[model samples]
Target chain A: MGQRPGDLSAPARLAGPDEGIGADELALATRNHGLPLEALRHDVTPPGLHYVLTHYDIPYVPDAGAWRLTVDGHVRTPLDLSLADLLSFPQVTTRVTLECAGNGRALLTPRPVSQPWLVEAVGTADWTGVPLRRLLAEAGADPAAVDVVFTGADHGVERGVEQDYQRALPLSVATGDDPQVLVATAMNGAPLPPQHGRPLRLIVPGWYGMAQVKWLRSVTVGDVPFTGFQQSVAYRIRRTPDEEGEPVTRIAPRALLVPPGFPDFMSRTRVVRPGPVRLSGRAWSGQAPVSSVEVSTDGGAHWEPAVLDPVVDGHRWAWRAWHHTWTATPGEHAVGTRASDADGHVQPLDQHWNRGGLANNAVCFVRVVCVADACWP
Target chain B: MGQRPGDLSAPARLAGPDEGIGADELALATRNHGLPLEALRHDVTPPGLHYVLTHYDIPYVPDAGAWRLTVDGHVRTPLDLSLADLLSFPQVTTRVTLECAGNGRALLTPRPVSQPWLVEAVGTADWTGVPLRRLLAEAGADPAAVDVVFTGADHGVERGVEQDYQRALPLSVATGDDPQVLVATAMNGAPLPPQHGRPLRLIVPGWYGMAQVKWLRSVTVGDVPFTGFQQSVAYRIRRTPDEEGEPVTRIAPRALLVPPGFPDFMSRTRVVRPGPVRLSGRAWSGQAPVSSVEVSTDGGAHWEPAVLDPVVDGHRWAWRAWHHTWTATPGEHAVGTRASDADGHVQPLDQHWNRGGLANNAVCFVRVVCVADACWP
Candidate 1:
């Protein structure tokens, strides 16, 4: 059953430092998970290791063979395609990095009581699918259409508004050649896993994860801007409830290091050996390719340029690897990293706060204590 | 560097309701995740959707082909085998259900501040591998051995003690014919995923998740009991920290329903239509095959029998499906479910309190509100 607008829970509130995450928030965190920072070692994260944030129940699509994708609305000709029909189209594989808009939401001073994600809310995947432009061209799209809305089978209520989990993309981006969007059918050379949208899903390269509508069912072209609940209400950067905030779209530049050495089970404080250590991590941005990455051994107080790996062809949307070698001394220290995109967009030392805690691309710092080998068993 | 016994964090403490989950706890929850309750609909949960609780980082197993498994200690002949060696053995695949000892820990009165899992810390998977008995026999296992300690490559510090992650099983269980344990190399018919110990892992049927060691490296047959931190200190049932609590082993009898209807984003409250709703869920127990399941519609004030699906051969370790149909009227109601095993171990209505909060299998309740169709947008 659909939920009524009046059948709402308490309005979203920021939790103070002393305020514990409520049972409701804990429930969300338990089901949705972030990629462990150490998983950064893999160029293409295994499907199971990739981050996931499902807003609703993973719909049970028992028979994918019978699933169909419908394309209509503001089009010269409507088209209905089955899984087999979609498979018949020419396929393209793209390695793309997808990051949640609220990746560092948990680091905020008074954090938005939502997923409470840390820097781990990101992953790179090999997505294979039919380009949206090809599907739209075959369907005879109308040039007058301003936006295209994608709908997923998963449904739920958000802020008291019941929706079919719809999100709209500007027609330009939907049909553009630079960063082509796709009706993704496979991930990492295999059919999409259930949590990644088993039967079908939309893959918008370089865009934040929210734009990649999953468990896709239909595509609708519209003349006017499609202002659905997901597009107009949620995923926005607002300072106040009544403000018409800027929309959160592309991922901001960010760099996260694969924590060096072993971890303490409780505090996750890293313990390292005193010697030459090679610190490495991945950096990326949606606005442009990451051109430079900086390492800070004393947190953000000091910085040094790190060597960047050559960007490979056909993987511009994926993260670029960077590494630095540091001669360590035995003591407690903080290590940090940041990135700058080709467009000159740099990660801020401290993130700007917003009511919804969206697009937090702040520098990441890891606390480490270097000691002698004899300290352990 | 390994952590010293003196470099410890504060001892584990149970959190009162008002006290918030510590940042350390949130850090752990973000990296580890539980299975979504709705995923129970699938008989074999997809590997990606399966529950994962890694104590340390998912070690970078760069090349599974080059990985080796060593069987030594107390064996008549030490055996060093490569991945190909393990794969060449007689292969066996079994569907087994695994539940965490801390499944319902968060629901306790004063909860242990760990992963904070609710009722979702469980999943079933088809594990393919070589039988442990076959491997032990090939290595010439010593019949006088009392325990078999399995070691994983992933290493970190727990309770200030630095060591490789390890767990031990009784000699009989390791080489038994009834509930065969496996040196699993694959999951769900494919090579084991990275998070699931890409190279190798141990799968002990009918035991709690703690007994399943991922990222396996070596096996040591020993005459003395294994006293690792994970085996003796953690995963125990105790009244106080000083008590030598009983070791947690098998899964308790429990049932969890696929929460019906749609969920509200903030509170996860369920909304349903006024009609006949087919309530369904999965139930299981490690002690024995699930013999019965019951459904309660009024906060568990009363319960009625639910039909159980017949168990299939070769998959006796998996959960059994159960279903019940409820004709509903428009109003708010609490729906609950409970299960009993063949050994007469029934899920408790209220779980008993403990220091570590392990093996709690209390009834699960989902609050749902029934409304008319017009109530939705």
Candidate 2:
């Protein structure tokens, strides 16, 4: 996880059985607005269990004490600053979702051939960091430095390819003040856990987890593009059928892109343990925020609007949890849900096929299993 | 790893050394070429320390249990054969390189963000698999089936949007008897490495790694484009800068776009041990076989044809190993190398920048380090 600055592993864990106390690990604590993993029942993904994507293995990075962000690639005034130097500037926090580009690649058309991933491929957290613009101004970055190179403490060789843990972003995005963009050192209001990037990380709200690099390191202002494999190669989208089969290079605006609704825990089988079963799940968009999440008790005929939480940070990629309630039932029935963003985007009727399994925002039908008695397999 | 068959978290290991010392591994050994390393090396990459990218974690997957090659989807007679079923048919071999679509992305312009890989991504290897033609004929694939979807054994989630681990080649490529399209179970004549995908992988020479789906599960026949995430969203090439200030989308044929020549040991500092230092490395083409190789000691000013071994396959992505003998030097000098294919295709000065870093076959360079009898630090 020492590859990028804000890599995603898990953040919290119980120190003693008493740690991670009630509500402390709750999703609301972060305002990510997602459903509880009622199946797992416990709040918050424990550190070890949190999803992780580390470009390089654990890197022994320069201490925050000596850490400096250098801006000189194609910049006017080359600037270098220590952690304290970085912190000397203003700071802000934003709640956002960091999902790996490869998170759902397994379901791709050619089955994106990369690392395997599981359900625990994403998480949300509050990030605090200096605005990239602030650093750019200080460095007097040249517009010619169209790209910014980000280096890390991890290094390795892959496929006869000598690689340094690094990647580059367009100066446009790097210079913007996305509240979701953070030079974060904490998670859930605590210093980052080792697995979650102990010292610092770059929390890129809507982009895939790969962009939100883990481990605090150096940021270089460059003229040409940074040629890190992660930047130039992996985590891209291939839209056409051609000889070289070029890739979708830049990050697409974040959008849920599918099944236009928050998931609902309809018709609970928790007959005895429940007064009235409450249904809940998270809905979000990368391209646009949610317009209104719709739920259907009978497949696609009848529809109802689920309660919406206040959207914050203008983060479209961060999902909002929507909840519904249903009385206990005696048998199996079909229940489906869909979500749409502010742009009137609706979930698809079926799957759209592509090479890699990316942008899979599709309508999901969660079959409700209610019983006269609590009987779950 | 199980959820995504090709994920890195699998338990696939190098089976007790010789567990993989079969025909495929033997092929590599017989040539006395290449150094296989378990991990990366520092500075000058030891032949043994080069990285290897495999489709599957386990190697040498036979059709023994459930390794069935299916041509379902929209085909006439969906072919579902076992490993042996595939091998029994006339087998063929090709010398080609399997490169990640993200290979030369590091050289892109906008500097789309992702992995931090230095050069050394592309590698060539010998591969033997079933001709897609043979299986297509046997499956009685309908002429109407415009595209053939190649699937893998890995389990994955599917968005109603798209949930398929498959790639589709026009019926022409899929049905071509060209020996290059293979259901390869071995690499370099040995059981394929797990990471490289064992139990039979697809070797579609002349394209990026995306075309070669490792741990092949099933091959389906479809009349439509495979709309999986990998196909649609991943691997897309961003053309020129757009009005949206984002990368555009398109696809090109994928290949190991490398500059001409075998690797020239960039030894800036000479080795004290004057023993013959063998110059060796692998080479392959995305669309064709490498016809010849050359090396330069004085920066491409003078050139000499280097020794190239007999490559294994034709018009395949499987790569070949080339080596040469060089005398030790104790002075500072520059070295460069280049390679060309049968079709006269040579490496480019640089790849055209697209949003996604996909196929980039630029020539490779090594700055030899030869000191006055100084030990490599």
Candidate 3:
């Protein structure tokens, strides 16, 4: 719903190629592409509207003197390669979307404190690069070592706590193939941008942006976790704020905390002729791939099945477009979409707010203005 | 473990911050601050070093522009001011840790695919900043709007795909004392460096790095969410990569995926006259705060409570450091930490893996070197 013939009233600004969230721009309405409607505006998230995260730091704008991916940690052949060297590895390409775990925070209830996201945290693109697994294989990392630390170019301190923006991933996640994660140098068919990790970045199709460490640096394989400031105690949750006295673990998986429908704006219009209307939208899974998408015309009582679009198998990152048609006789109507993942998990309806905006996967909903079928009266 | 006279060789020459992981420096060692005698060493993660995540996109170089704090989400009146403005309000600080969601990946059986991060994904720090909840009151956002979106200046559009660094917070979280989210413009005592968010950056005491958007831009208040790709579909699970139709909806809370004990390389150097050797470490929560931390010395056998370090009540973002001594008889011991939050949620031993490394909270382990006092003969 971004553009309508005469809707020049809406801002028609194009995000500069390099400009991310401009320092001066005020956040108004925003959403992550990976999030659902109630949580995010699905269709209208423009290209200049994606989200990003770095493991250690932001795009290094690496000094030409030092631009390499060093393979250290517990490995047989400690290796380091220049950007040019990465090019020599067999390149791989896949269309993937990187999202931040906290992407859909805008809609969560209980009201947690977090980022002021302008819709567009999720971004899907054809990523071309070297498979990190391929590199691990070539480097001959110790199979016993399970963690892989991905350092970024961004740097700084967080209090007396000198810290890095680095994060770690499991060997399994590092080598899976739903989309086959990779150290991407190309996105959507172009070279990476300074804001998007120019020389190299990780393209982890179905993860929160943090997993797709923006600026790539060294990949350390180790026998034990490095416990860097970022990996040891951050990004966690327990049952409640009062629950943890010693150390707490993490938040449990919850359904997309949407109202029931998504991208309602796309279905919006001052005028709507009712007849056989095909309601269409997209549904996806964060905890697992979605199996079915349910739609409700009436508030929440009965639900009708909607056809799901085809997506690459097990590609949890890509979303499935869904559609359902309804006979018309309209006044006002409510529509909602609920996704059920392969794990029998369905988008939930509500979530009590906690301190950190951890996991809020509630059902999504929206109100619609319907009109009677046009006819000669 | 790093320095011991009349025993191990003198500490290896300290590698310059810019130096790559080399031989002597290959095995990283750190004497965890609070813990004594029981030091551990790994091939990565040097003490005095950890990953960092800054909020601003611009480098933190001494510059001209003054920094300000903006509070507009769901408030009655939107407020924007500079670093001076934030400082004028009030100042507060807390010790906290920020770990990447997928810190222990190599340990996952079947080896999940993604960045093979072995070590160095955790860190701790004392943070100082103005409480955000108070600012929201100052801004006067509508009470009905329960969500606030935070945008950042670091923007990137690659191959028609645009990604921004942003996040959203629930009203409860934004205005709370515990978790006590901060609009931080400084680290330790110094002004935030350009590498970090110079003028300002948010310090969400608890939660994954994904929620901590760097290069923050603006904040918006709304009754419902404006979904972006990141909010809905990413950071989810796709149970069983083999089968897929629609992806799952829920966003699992981020947690530490503790790996099996590092029983290898590390041997018990003490424990000759085993008595009560205090075991201490840190644990944190994401959505909710931690209630208690328990330690398991015999795999999942019996559990004992650890003395929790001081942590502010209602603070979900901050972690509770803990200590508990255990008497041992030499050989090898598996020490693990598991915690529960206010919601009664506890950490598990395993978690499902996805292509993208998202919320991976599993009870983690700690291996100790307990040698029988060198078999003093």
Candidate 4:
């Protein structure tokens, strides 16, 4: 409320490093949402159940069929493609997992003051789209292009920088076949929902959600590394605001429990009857396929290996299911899970803090109580 | 971190009346979302854009095909129907606007420490299912039945009481022909999304969301009113902790603006250029159809009527679109909107206080700036 309209370059209000979440952060949290742990029980997150984080308003695309995508910049032949034109191309559907780079930001001490995600910012979806390489090949990208900048229709100001939502991928990643990048037009066999970027969006497999630009409108074959605000200013893992830190990409290995039993309405703390309870959850990694998962019934003091579901044929980029059977006693306990990928990147037992709190894939912990049978409904 | 699991009756941590939102409240906000103001532009909110608030975890129905709805208790003929059986009945679709009883709870002074909703907890959807009266008629309700209790598969503890999520409607309301209630199986044009009660749910038009139980499992006809925890403890308009107050029901007449321009990332404040701007939004009421919507650009000092879209042949329960054109000069302004219903219910200029913060339909206010053209994006 104290902001001056003329102060165009001023940073808006944020929660103090040591203070509780401010109204502004709560406002953002209410607008965007994190996946509920219970929803992890589903193999493919259903519509509306998937976690959503939009930096700007979901732009109103009055007529999606009329929307066009332009491929220009360093391309040898600039091309304009309509929805029907893109749909005519050979379509491929891939099951991929997407996670917010700031999944555990709020859990960090001196928490980064945006979104406030807490380990629930991940979901798997079957995205159907035309391969980006096919589009780039048709447009004849210039050999010297270094990055493919994707621009979305959503526009807003972030960190005092006003611009359209844009993100860029290295040219090699965009054209590679290992994990195909796609210009997605459908999700889960249905036309894209408005919030998930209806009309068109980019789906960068194995990368953090920032690489998947929604409401995509323009794709530029750039000769230089794209240095937009989102590309450089935000989504960076830094120790301080002044230094330009590493750009955040790829989902870090993480496992989350499905939160066994029912949750208290206000606290969301789990209450289960003392018995042999099956603990299950999903684990995924963008850097590499998840190789193993470990479970701890008594916090991080001791750990045991959990059974990992065999990798499916075509879902190498989707999450792997894992489970552990625990004979719970009647008492309070902290349950935790950690996932490690084939690349040997293990979740840290404790959090490593960064200025932006990007990619804090620490061990996921859930506080629960195993109540006596008589007390449970 | 301070709670004792064994002390079942103790209230969980709550933010003091004057304190900022606690982490627990923020956690709730991230799990549930309010409809973004821009979404009002859609006549029928797309999948995932609709507001959702699940009291407990979204119950996992392993096989929705095998799920059954039982009508028992005082009914003349207890009936158990499968998903297929319910689908064979005559289906009716209704476009209804459902609002949480606690829509503007967060705006109240000494705010209620619950979901912390601020105006966005409302959405309009086309719900398709069989009418509840048809089912009741088939089951042959007892003549002396006074209430119809709905029980959902979701079970959880609240205020130390454990039970399945349940709510009841007076028999008259459930059987009345006006604004027929439906046992909805599809939302929009697709099967119910998980977060929106997959398999089946009850949709009572013109009532608050609590009466429309999701993940529905049973209906009980009773000679006495149902006294479940959700009915007696929560969702009440209590003046003091000990007072019963009135039972919360029906959406209050309210109007919200589709925030005109781009928003700042952290604060979500709007900024616009110095020129003519068209403003549009939606208004609705539960007690009666929305009759008028008024707009105020000078912080409620003066008001002007907005043009309301003509009512369609159907969709009597859906929201009415309203718009106003304003000539802007460079300065800060607080824009407000207020709606009145045909029943003579007008939204208050200031919020009314209550213990549970239920049914607070105060005027909606949005802060914005008509910045000089030079500073605009």
Alpha-carbon lDDT, every model: 0.89, 0.48, 0.51, 0.87
- Residue-level lDDT of model 1, residues B1-377, one tens digit each, is 45454564557888976777778888888888898889999999987788898888888988888898999999989999999999899999999999888888888888888878888988999999999999999999999999999999999887778889999998999999779999999999989888888889999888999999999999999999999989999988998989999999888889999999988877888878898999999999989989999999899899999999888774778999999999777778899999999999999998778888898999979989888877665
TM per prediction = 0.98, 0.42, 0.42, 0.97
Q: 1 or 2: which has the higher TM-score?
A: 1
> Which candidate do you rate higher for DockQ, 1 or 2?
1
Q: What are the per-residue Cα lDDT tens digits for candidate 2 across B1-377?
A: 01121121222112231121222222111111111211111112222122333221122233345666666766566666777777788877676544466554434443333321224454455677778777777777788767777776533222211133556667777777553478787666766654455577787765666777777787777777666655655556545333223212111222221221112111111122243555655555555567777766555677677787674433344445566666646443345556777677775655565555555555444444343323322
DockQ, computed on Cα atoms, for candidate 3 = 0.01
Model 3 spans > 4 angstroms off: A1-46, A53-66, A117-120, A157-160, A176-179, A242-271, A286-288, A312-317, A327-330, A352-354, A371-377, B1-377
**What's the C-alpha lDDT at position A329 in model 1?**
78
List interface RMSDs for the candidates, in order: 3.0, 21.8, 29.5, 3.9
TM-score of chain A of each: 0.97, 0.72, 0.74, 0.96
The DockQ value obtained for model 2 is 0.01
Root-mean-square deviation per candidate:
1.7, 21.6, 23.8, 2.1
Indicate the worst ten consecutive residues by lDDT in candidate 4 chain A.
A1-10
Expressed as tens digits, the lDDT of each residue in A1-377 for candidate 2 is 01211111222121232121111111111111111122122122322223455543444333446655565666677777666776778876666665555443332334333332322245556667777777777777887667777766555433223355666678888876553356776676666654455566776666666666667577778767666666554444445433333333322222221121121111111112223655555665555667776666565678777776676555454567666665534444455567777666676645454444455444545444333322321
Count of clashes, each model: 3, 168, 220, 0
Q: Top TM-score: which candidate number?
A: 1
